[model samples]
Target: MVQADERPASDTDLITLGRRIRHARTARGLTLDQLGERVGSAPSLLSLVENGRREPRLSLLRAIAEAVGVPLNDLLSTEPPSRRAALEIALDRAQRGPLFAALGLPALKPSQKLPIPVLEQLVGMHQELARREEEAIATPEEARRANTELRLERQARDNYFPQFETIAEDLVTRAGHTGGALTHRTVARIAEQLGFTLLHVEDLPRSARTVTDLRNGRIYLPPASTPGGHGLRSLALQAIAHRVLGHERPRSYGEFLRQRVEITYFAAACLVPRTQAVAFLEASKRERDLAVEDFRDAFGVTHEAAAMRLTNLATVHLGIPLHFLRVGDDGALFRGYANDGVPLPQDVTGAIEGQLVCRRWGAREAFARRDKASEYYQYTDTPAGTFWCSTQTGSGDAGAFSITVGVPYAHAKWFRGRDTPVRRASTCPDPSCCSRPSPDAAERWAASAWPSGRMHQQVLAALPRGAFPGVDDAEVYAFLDKHAPEQ
Candidate 1:
């Protein structure tokens, strides 16, 4: 019986072996006919094997090895016999690749007359084309899966990252920040310390929130007075954090999501330093008055940012497990994170974004309130457990949204809204739980109501294709070229 080593190797390995056999045959001063005659094979068959067009049987390989005066193991070696052989094998494999076949171009034959430079250039171009093809293949479903996986990973760590905290602390300290609002001046200092100059541009790319010119050591951002909800200090810090964290162009959607999480975490840490935020939260907990509004006011950041920052530090430092959610007015989830046992709605892909929130939850309930000026608080009882949440409503270019921070019932004593009487019961993941209409309502309107649905264009479209998805590469390049200073 044939041994495991006698089994045919993979196609790639066979290609390398074929090149080695050809090199050995020529070194032994034998033609294909002479070698094949010794191995009891036809010259045409030997030629096919030598050119990587066919695979030889193990017995035939052993016979050829003996005829060529080389060890059997030498014929099985993975490396090409020489640099020229390596280039030739690469060209052959590239031509066989799916990307090349998709182009419908005829394959080029590598010959002794082909110069090394031409082979190198051809191989390099094929490699680049393969990379671009890979980037173009990212789909919306792939992006959703990546987002789901990243959310689960962050949830495992209680949504906190100490490494980013340490980096932010060091940068803030060097910038001479002594707590309080973390003013724009201090953020600028941090950027300058990292060898970057912040430039407010009127013509920044529409798709980009901020752009970094690595060659010119510049960061371009929208003007401070611009109505976009993103804070100038936060945007600038996020851009600089990318450089500080040594981030590179993401090769996959998963890497891109991870890098975005890291940079945003770094910026949040800088905006609300861990040392200060932790101390404040600890004090609030001691007073049994932990409130997101106070946290937002103290840090001079937005309500959503403050609530998200709570998710980053509450469980890790304050010993309080909780959940955070950002829900749109239409009751669809935009973002969600939980270390507490509360169950959030998710689709088949395990993605929570764009999934409908239970109508009974605090996130959706807050949208019904007439008083948009004040925070809404509620207690929700779910299958997992009871949670008390505080939600704040805000509007942006996209529309209205509610940001909610919730803790399990047992941990509610440390928060301010624990005494509120508003409460709800939910049985989500069940079809009857806020998803189906009541018997009377369904009988009245289900048959007669024919509503037009607003289709989400992004859902039907493929994910943006490029190293940085959704960014217009041509516009960015043109902007840079126009603004680049003379050398």
Candidate 2:
């Protein structure tokens, strides 16, 4: 007695195998009935196998191969015998897939009269549908994991990307930026060089910072009077960076996060061209007067962007490993990166986003200062090692946040904030550090307090669905339709 092959095969694999068997039989000038007779099988049953409607037993496959004068391996090959057979197999698999069943569409039967172009078009549509469905269903956990992986990768490289630096330098040269802070006029020149026209629109999509109409060579941005208008140059450059980098629709959450990082780095590099920024940094280091505020002023960027740019250049160019953090007033870690062994709070997934930062760190302590006009500096002793940090407070629509940059105690001597008198010890990743209440306070308030917790909806929700996650496709399309000039 012979058994069917117990190993599971996908519908696609089985379909391809069946097509190969049929092709082999036909090539040998044998009809199904004649082949079935030789293999001791009925013609009708052989027809079912030939059509991919049934799985033939291993012994029967061997007999069929023998009767068709083809090697068993040839019949078992997964490749379709020809292009038409490949298209038929794809269509059949798509029809049997869950997406097709969910749509409740009538299946198209493959016949000699079905045009090859029609088959190609249908298969292409099905492939796109499958890709979009996958993109839509990426859960929050997947997004977190992807972000965590990206952070680790960037951290390993000290957040420095020389290729993006080269691209930015080239673009800046093309824009005629000879040095100093990259101005808005120069940024516009860069866009023009890239074949894009800058169009300030009041009705730009709320979810998007910048929208590029690739078809019409237009980039739409919020007017300069907007709250985030200070960063318009960076935003416009980020939009153009996508086109410059040849970014395609992301197939997974990881790819999206990667593209986001790449574009952000490119934008920052363009804002503070590497050669100029590094020279200024090297001078600051030599003077032992390195400061994020000065960097921000020189580059005409926000404190956060300056801090991030410092991380991008510190270890690679200045020979100093550093860490950067953006913490909310409520102590949540919005963004963090470190190459200097600074201990950052992270979940089991290694994600720092949304995790509550230690109150003892400079990022949180900066918020408590009465004078918000100046940067706050501190020395924090942690389980890993002591670190010196400088933090600056700023507010946006989402309320207050602190941007911080730090280095290990050894490297702190080169920074201006090294003389700060404020010092604190942090035992983070330990509940007692800042997470747990003090014994006296807990005894007094634990039984009396009944305050309702403020919830963050995004924490409990899945990542927004789309080719570019968090973007509304309908809104973007409608905006383009409303703004597109008559063609």
Candidate 3:
């Protein structure tokens, strides 16, 4: 396995790299001063780095790499002098183009920051080559021609897309919007929905600077931060917007480039809502019951959001029983719970199979039969045999009941269909083997653990609904107290 730190860096032609960085910086409308703030260097030093006049120290190079958003290898060449020298002249000349300079202030070499349309044409060439490769087995001549063309296109795109991120942002900001909502999941969904590919580069080797010449269907983003707080994301976003979105002509790249512009802070808030929920939870502790509807009203969120909030609330505060309460005559376990102070296993979300088994045995029966020596026990025989293993925690006022339960459900859904085999399905049929041993075993696992909404409603509907009224904490504690394990 290639450990990340040992991975070799980019070996792009250095002169080409200089031109690429200079062109990208200018296109983003950032002055030396503005860019300086991001990369943490004086404008003159930045100017020298862009012009290839100064050999940037490793520290400075890493910063510039992050600010320009190209990988370190993209900026500094590791290729042998013979190969690198041959490419440098063309790269340097290409960087001198007025089109590259027009995007911003000119640095020494400027021609290489070519138009996005040019890059797109190159991608079309690659696609054609790939298709042809399948038809004719490559002769020596054909293979050489194909390899040269692909390398040229890859280098061009690698140098330009970092600038595209900037252009995309400008267009979006101009249209009175921001990037998509910012949660791990929502950001992913939005990127896919917009036909944008997401790649994480924070784990790449030698900290190569990232580039995203979108015209070439390439995006480069750093895996982690460099000195001066510069990261691949900022650079990649800048490159994505400026290089990809700035075209005057109509193009397919713009569709992707424009999609990124639609991302907005408001949309992001809907996904995370951290600030809004934290405040509301802090205030709700004063209330006695902490009803879901009441939390919804207080937080100005939907009832479901309120339920989510309750689970989150426990992450911040301890000693609260604020469960996203779902009840039916069948049984009541936490659908969503926040214990506030409990330490628990991270993989508790899909522990319902175990709970169903315990419920089948009847809480009363499990408590009566609880024995430390008991290894295997039956919970139910009808419908399908249900099995359970039981465990308890603490004693006296601190005693807790834990029963691992399992019952047969439609295995097809678990496997996504009957045709496919189930993978890594949980094996917690034995009560003793169920429930990870952790203090927050209940709460940590409960957060986002339940399949609620429609599936939960179905589970509720299957039960005798009206048989159980909304029970109080005291009643709940009283019922459990009877079942509590003896000292």
**Displacement of the residue 458 alpha carbon in candidate 2, Å:** 1.6
TM-score of each: 0.75, 0.74, 0.20
Error of 3 at 5 (Å): 64
lDDT of 1 at 253: 70
User: Using lDDT as the measure, which candidate wins?
Assistant: 1
Clashing residue pair totals per candidate (backbone < 3 A): 0, 0, 56
TM-score of 1: 0.75
Clashing pairs in 2: none
lDDT of 1 by residue, 98-124 (tens): 779968999999877899999999999
Local accuracy by lDDT, each model: 0.90, 0.88, 0.38
Off by over 4 Å in 1: 1-137, 226-230, 444-447
lDDT of 1: 0.90
